[model samples]
Target chain A: MMEERKTKDFPRSDSASGSSDQVVRTIGLSKSFGEVRAVADLDLSIPRGCVYGLIGPNGSGKTSTIRILNGLIRANAGRAWLLGEEVPVHVNICRIGYMPQEMAIYAELTVLENLELFAGMYSLNKESLAQRADALLDMIDLTERSDSLVSTLSGGMKHRVSLACALVHDPELVFLDEPTVGVDPELRMGFWDHFSDLKRAGKTIVLTTHYMDEAVRCDRVGMMRLGRMIAEDTPRGLMESTGETHLEDVFLHKAREGSA
Target chain B: MNLVRAYAIALKTLRSLKHDRRTAGFLVLMPLFMIAIFGYTFGGDIKDVDVVVVDLDAGSANGSVAALIREDLAGRDVLRIGTSEDRDEGMNAVKDGEAWAAIIFAPEFTVRVEEAIEASRTGSSAAPATVEVHIDASNPNIAQAVVAELQTAVQAVLVGYYGANPAITVSEDRIYGEDAEFIDFFAPGVMGLAAMMITFMLSIISFVRERSTGTLDRLLATPATEGEIVGGYALAFGLVALVQSAVILAAAMLLFQVSIAGNALLVLLTIFLLGIGSQGLGFLLSSIAKNEFQAVQFTPLILFPSILLAGVFWPLEAVPDLLRPVSDFIPLTYAVDACRSVMIRGWDAGEIWPQLVVLAGFAAGTLLLSAYSLKKRG
Candidate 1:
């Protein structure tokens, strides 16, 4: 469905949104909590059919930026756009998917029940819900344990269930916060393969993670520190510009340069 | 505002309870246990109160005034009358807490009553008879019961002598509750209170869980609006309040034999309104809390005032003059009033519309406030 829209020559969006190709865009986006600034004047853009990785330490503003764009919280002093509409737009929120850092699924419900719940919120009728849920469950490899209560599942399995729930609606733009935090190496590879599949299908993914090694797999990596994007480019460009062979060394060099 | 969205949220909440046996048990049985405790403490007749009677009547043996009154007391089920020759011994029994009260007849009590009756007939002054009652008022309930029993006996004995006292006669014509008990008064109040506590506590805690667990943020990112979420919670908790009411009413009627004079469904309707309003209030207050621990703190803040001032534990009349105005503002006061009017006084909805209107106002107002609070920005 998303591939069809990408192939079609749609008209340019309003001037505020640069073009229909930028699935996610932000300008001077800032947010604060009391005296601490979470996201300070951060400018970012993620194009269609691209896997974007937002790499930052614990106190950096990766999650805050995603929250503002998702309309979960409004930006303090900036504007954003998602899917060619000015953000915090109530009407167009269904086209985006969000998987928060916390285990947000209901612990008392079954794995299948969690996916169906998010599907219902998007107003998917019964027939579509069953079809979408079955496919998602198969992808997540929880088809057999769909009826088991989530509270009884293993930690890695629970994370997989959260991901399945996020993708049940097949959102055109997806935001995943630390999506592979607790997964085993084998499952992580399986998840990366799924993301590659989604990108080929013309879906945009914006994910935040501290795993420096994973940034190599993303099409573009945004190096963030103190609510500011220090460096953003293709992995090879970042490695070459910073004279660092490893992606982890590239981040350390950029972070130290920004601090100095 | 959308029915499908609202119903969907309600279904998810109810479905979560199906596997959680402990929480479900707390939801249904907590109110039942509380009602049992309150009913046991407040309802019932004071039975088998020991009383000593010292009769010193020096006139008429068979048709004596003292014997008539004593026989009247002994026949009733409330008291067990024991004979005593010395008034001091009877007084000592009451003082020692062995007996609830002492009934003493003064010497020549029958002669004095008869003389008093003649004096009244002839329009002359005559000495009054003294039927002295010495009671231990330690337990006020037992004391009141003993006094009421004695008054009935004395009145029955005196009725023949004076023939109903034509000039000072005032008959009580009850328009309602010809056979009301203390349980009858308490059942409706308990139902309202149980409903309020359950609905109020559940919504606050449940909402806080949603926020702390990050589920609320996930939902907010979707197509679901804050109003739809709040409406869904109201639907679910409102249904819970209804089920709690049914269980309470059934228990009250089956165990305590509390009969409803008017419609039972109207009584449930009143509690439902009150419960929905409380649920909204809970949701509104939940904004200040950061977690379930803080959310639990609000229960006492809301429960104590409603229980004390809402006429659940006692009537509004018993409330202090200063606090009566405060009582007027509590939604539970109107609920208890409406429930009592329906269960005991046989009042229909038309007669209790004012209370219903007040409750409905609470429901609408608090729900609006909750939805507004949920939306930091529209």
Candidate 2:
């Protein structure tokens, strides 16, 4: 079954392929913690240079899917690919950046130090790292607080630091889990602007959030419920198809249909 | 493994510690504090015990037994002799805790001692001269010191009286650790214990924090392998342990005058290896703990057993025979043995290779296990 999925997913590596534009592809990707299936038989494909928001409530297997894609955890069944390379493989790890929902930045370290540490992990040279760190700090509007320890930062500032650390290596693919959960509306607008800039610069972004407003900004959104994708469409398309005015109503409509 | 990546992890960890002033203070000052507490208070020798003596023996025509005891014990400073009017008074002193022990010499002590010596020559049994020792026994060390001092003084007097007869005299020879004291034996073990404890505790708490705070998940997503992560931690903690050991050894030497007879570098190397092994053990143990509070629960589990079985405060020979084999399995045991051999016996690498090899094996095995544990993510 694994071989079948592998061959079906990748046929002739050098040839122009159906998945050529897709940065992330997964089929029948399943994961379980104890008896509860956090993610079950998830089939997802994310195209390059597109912002794909995984919209779901809490406990909807969004974090699990991201973790599996980033090789932090393994799928119980099926396989995944990142940047045309098989995930759970070490070769393309440097090409991918992940920002976890929790505050993953080292609390004891300053914001600049956290950025430098992540940049160094990717073997970035001193000149490039310093330049990139400054740009990222400015982008996050945290240039003044870069020298302060992350623990002293407010929750939203620390979230910005985590996002900056994820992007410090300038990876082609970035996975952000709930990047704007506690962010202020103004900062969330800034994050969306920065993400749009990243998308325009040809970086593929996959993010998970429950906010309908954030979901509306994505090029496409996958609405997840109970370890499965109930619907996948553009924000306007989803509202239109469900005959609803808002993404929240559309999500409720799809969830009712799924349970039915 | 990528050396640069591993070094990056090490640098990040060190940077984090730089900001964590409390942990940094613990790392630098804890060893000094431990040395001061253990070296000056808990590890000092029992000395200058007071003993009340009611020497009722008047004389034996040649000398007085009480005078001889006073002469031997008074000058040596091992025992402080206090005179009592009678056995009741001497016993009262011991009972009142004024003295550690009371030596009540029989009135016929000298006569009976001489008679016993003469009777031994004639191959006949005689009544033995008795010295009844009434001890407080509250502090066993002081009580034991009193008894040991009395025996030594008595033996010296009898041996002098007999003029070193070949038939019943014991000769002395010098070997390793000539005139070694308790502090000398204790210092090296303290070094090993300090290194093991600090390295283990820091790695465990640090790793647990990494996991709980999601830094480990972020790191795992990077290009860094689990081996590189563990290696990075081991390197940083090993260096810290080296510094800690140095502080402890210097303090032990300067404050307690603990001697180091062998290559000091070799002793330090053993301690460093123990640190590496302990860090690996910490990593392995951290995998079982979900949070820092659970990690703290592991302290006494690792500490008390190592202290009791690793021969830190005492020799392995002093442990019960049934429990002797258990000591060999503890990593700190090999460290303590190697360190003590180097610092006390002046043993070089050739004589201490087995211990070094075992320690190396322990480090390698635990490090591999730690890496495996880290890689075994759900």
Q: What digit string (tens of lDDT, one per residue) describes model 1 on residues B39-158?
A: 543453455678888898876643578888888888876887887999889887765446767888877887777777778889987766777777754334455677788778778777
lDDT of 2 by residue, B21-54 (tens): 6567657765675564335333434455677888
lDDT of the structure predicted as candidate 1: 0.80
**For model 1 chain A, where is the 10-residue window of minimal lDDT?**
A1-10
Candidate of highest TM-score: 2
Model 2, residue B264: C-alpha shift (Å): 0.8
Q: Residue by residue across A1-260, what tens digits does model 2's lDDT show?
A: 23334233544542222348878888778888999999877888888999999999999999999989888887888777787777785777888889998888899999999999999889999999999999999999999999999999998898889999999989889999999998999889989998999998999999999998779999999999989999999999999999999999999999999999
When candidate 2 is compared with the true two-chain complex, its DockQ is 0.59
DockQ of each: 0.42, 0.59
lDDT of 2 at B11: 100
Looking at candidate 2 chain A, the ten consecutive residues that score lowest on lDDT are A10-19
Candidate maximizing lDDT:
2
